[model samples]
Target chain A: MSSATTFLLTTIMISFIINIAISLYGVFAKPSLVKKFIALTIFSDSVNSFAILIGFRRTPLGYPSIAVMPSPPQSVEDLKRFVSEAVDPVPQALVLTAVVIGLAVNMFLVGLIMLYYKYYGSTSTRRVKI
Target chain B: MSTLQDPLTGIAPLYLIAVAFLTAALGLVIRSNKFFKVFAIVNTAIVFAISAYIMHKVVDEGIQLYFFGGYPAPLGIAYEIDNLNALLGLLATSIMLLSGIYSAWYMNFPRTYLYYTLFLTLLAGSLGCLYTGDYFNFFVMLEVLSLSSYSLVAYFRDSPKSIEAAIRFAFTGIISSSFYLLSAFVAYASFGTLTMADIALKARDLNAVTQFSGGVVGNVAIASAMMIALASWTWTFKAAIFPNYFWLPDAVPEAPTPISAVFVGVIDLIGVYGAIRMFYTFFGQGSIALQFRSYTLEIFQILGAISVFIGVFLLLLQEDVKKFIAYSTISHLGLIFMALSLDSGEGISAAILHTISNSFAESLLFYSAGIAIVAVGRSINTLGVLRKYRVALAGIIIAMLNLIGVPPLLGFWSKYLIFKAFLDTGKIYGVVILVLATGISAIGYFKMLFSTLKPVEKIREDPRLRNSMLADITIALCVVILIAIGALYMLSPSARKFINEIGYNVIEGYKAYYAFLSSGS
Candidate 1:
């Protein structure tokens, strides 16, 4: 309901849109293999960031955005009390795994790219026609 | 005493794992040409022993959880061996051993230790991914598998297309891994657990924050988990799903037949295994349902149909014998998925049977292709590669026929089961599409065979190239074994029951086992 919560949510959604646009551009327009690879990597990272953002929550007090479970403390005052939970951890773990997988994939791509360059002396996607 | 109590409990399997590690180490240390032979044989044997032991543990004791240094599941890394993993582990080892022996004679160049080292490492990486319970450990193993495969795909660095294909394959692999990790993060955050069992159990209770109409809808917790669950489909690209299948046919052709055999034949099995484990065990009844909601099964069904159609269509067009077989592999996987998407007892059983048979038939295709190429001293495209070598061509033709689901062959029985499954479910459209795909694929297989029987041009055959009578016989022998298995499935209900039980264990999860246990009780 608060202004800051609204602002954070909007920011996350906009970034996700931008990520999709950039990835589409790279996949469709890029003439070079390396560029497409870079674009895909960026797109995946952006998506990962969006996943983390979705899990964010904000409290009435000055605390980090997080999720809150129901069932308040015993007293009425305790029930009204708010505390920030950390943002959802699931997306973050998924992102961590995705990033490492991305890196390994990048290393493999780089090796292939170098091999391609050695064989054809060009990184352009159109040049290496099978 | 704690770690080494029962014979089946821990000690033997651990020793076997050590032996597997030692084989990898030995492959690294030993540089002699002759040493590669020894290394390949010993390494494969050791891996087989380890897998067999693990498989025994899984069947007898349910999932086998091995915590290192006496640490338990929550605190330390766990190697979980359920039926799904146990099957894949056994599959990886057996195929690696079979194909490794077959490759010794098939590879044109001298047996360098590099080949064995890369081969064994690839085997280990795949097995590790199947067994490890922790998400992080699975990622690490996947990385090792991807790295090795990338190099193997580009091993014939002489061709630019090979490099290009590898690049594409690697990029796709990275994207898949990224999605996988993103999903993993989501699951971890949602449940605060990394252990597969715990995560599966905990993810179900996740309720979403109630929001306004325009805001985030549904349970936020479930949404996050679903996003994570769906991310894994990225790896389906690596698995050569319909649209993402471009690289497999091209990349697979560029590798040496043995490596190609491993890549197209065995590696995809690992992908299927990962998908099953993640979906069925970790996310099946838990977070996945919330995450996927209704679209998951529908999407899988659609993808399955497309892959089956596209793969068979492509297979029909393929002129290159190896490429034809590669396309067939994709088409077969599509059929497997179709059966899997059905999500029935019989349907799942059909998929598992198809997976096993296809692995063998595809490997046989690669092996025969290699032998014929060497014999004729050119690729399969050159005329008379098969006709000039009658015995060799016959062997490959039989394999190709087997591939096309001809009666009494391995492919026939599995394809039949899938048809029966669709019919049982009254999926008329699926049945029609499957029959059509099989009909079209038969043409592709025949073409490959046709090329083999054509007369040879007057190209000079190398005198020093020893005619591998043994290799030809081995190819024939594998075909026989495949046919025998297929025939066994036809005649015996017990074999069907055995396979069905394994499938039920895999696709239905603990529910199947619980039912069986209760009946016994």
Candidate 2:
């Protein structure tokens, strides 16, 4: 790999790892349910970015394509060139699905938190015994 | 085009999935309780029929691969139905049908139309998980299963305990699902394909090339191992294995009883099926298994043994009857895992049989316990209060006996098969540990059973049990099925032979699976 590619990969990896660490700390160590929900969102989003990063590929011109096909290449030569240059599309599709599922889970958690507060008159889970 | 017109191969699984999803969507708009109840029953019955037909097709004609929209395997999603999944799909749909009928009386809360909708969605998600051949589709279906289950667990939102359990369940569930997604990303990054059969083919080719160089101890090997480990962790969490099992006891008991039955009977079993499918079908070939087979088997073996011990130990201490049954589920699942870990034809057969028996037994137990709870005026802290309901008490006894593997019940034959598999593998330690676990669990089950049978001086009449005709019919249906299976096993050699064939099919289907992927038709 080139120096620019190595640098880009290293940066993405480090950011994903750091975000995951901090978010996990919030989810497990924090007592507040709302904080845990926020932390969960961060964790999910970071994982989604990691998936997208795996699909990232640098072209010969040193530009990264996001793997969304504009249209199928009509010519065989163009198809071969596109296949070599384009980023993998599968992980990008997976990330799209993950993002939507994450949003739904987050919304459900918020509703549950609201209900928990209404019932127990508190949002902190530390006092709630398992 | 004419080949694609084959009904059993092309549209059977889709019919099973679409019926549930459409019923759920229609239930939401209709908003009538009576209509929702009837719709859920009729819908699950249709799904059950389709599942049975698909299983019959798979047995007679062989593996059925249904590609959605007429797209082939690599380019579009497909539903791969072999004997293993066909049987599991049938088991899951049958339980859903019975529980859907029982829930007509069990779910007496206001706005029960929403319950029916969620119930159907959960069934659809499970059927999708069983049928999908694409890894990304599996992840999406898993999310659908988890989200609907989390909502169902908190359906009785009036109780603070139920909400608490739901939160914990959701938190653990999302974290585990993220691990699954991460594993998918790693697999796709390495293989450049999302279809399981294609991935398996590539992995096998890589293994063939690497075998001469050395065993697969390179970077690719490490990546594949990591993917398997991560995926296994997510599956174990869902299956409620030892370390990841804390949420199960809390979550299952808090849900309404019919939902509890779904959790233990359908959802947890699907989790085990996913793990088994991943190990046997997706990663059965190539460097991944070659490098990590022994280690993976040992990990599952030890984990399964520990879960068996801890689950039964916890069962002995539970005051609440629902929680007791939940812990028993964990213990039985551990046995199934132990069998699956052997990774042989006999072991897989044992696991499948146990899955069948345990699904029916656990659902029967939970529904019967639900009846006792209703008869005892909602909260059943002690078993003494159940003396008033003789009919439910008898059902509970039969169910408990089946769970304990007493003779002449379906559970006994499955447990016998598992023991035989352990002995066949020469895992003496596994056999000894399972025997000890079964012995201890029998004590706990008998204690719960006998207490329910004890007579009380003041026999109070419960209005709920007095009118629970539907629930009675459901429980009776489960008991009859259990007995019938047991009798068929004893009386017929062909029935036993058929189950063995299903097991061998799972073990031998890998070549055909790879052939289809490589053919690229």
The list of candidate 1 runs beyond 4 A from truth reads A1-17, A20-24, A40-105, B1-31, B108-111, B203-221, B282-294, B377-383, B387-391, B458-464, B467-470, B473-477, B506-521
Give fnat of each prediction, in order.
Answer: 0.55, 0.86
Q: Over the stretch B159-189, how does candidate 2's per-residue lDDT look in tens digits?
A: 9889999999999889998989888887777
Candidate 2 chain B, run of 10 with poorest lDDT: B208-217
iRMSD values, candidates in order: 3.4, 1.3
lDDT of 2 by residue, A56-100 (tens): 666876777544334655677777667668876677777888898
Give me the overall lDDT of model 2.
0.80
Per-residue lDDT tens digits for candidate 1, residues A1-130, read 4677677678878877788688858854787877887888787778677767756656555446444445655665554443335454545655676666667666767777777777777878785542
Maximum-lDDT candidate: 2
TM-score of every candidate = 0.82, 0.93
Q: Score the docking of each candidate (DockQ).
A: 0.36, 0.76
What's the distance in Å from true for residue B114, model 1? 2.8
Per-residue lDDT for A79 in model 2? 73
Candidate 2 lDDT for residue B50: 85
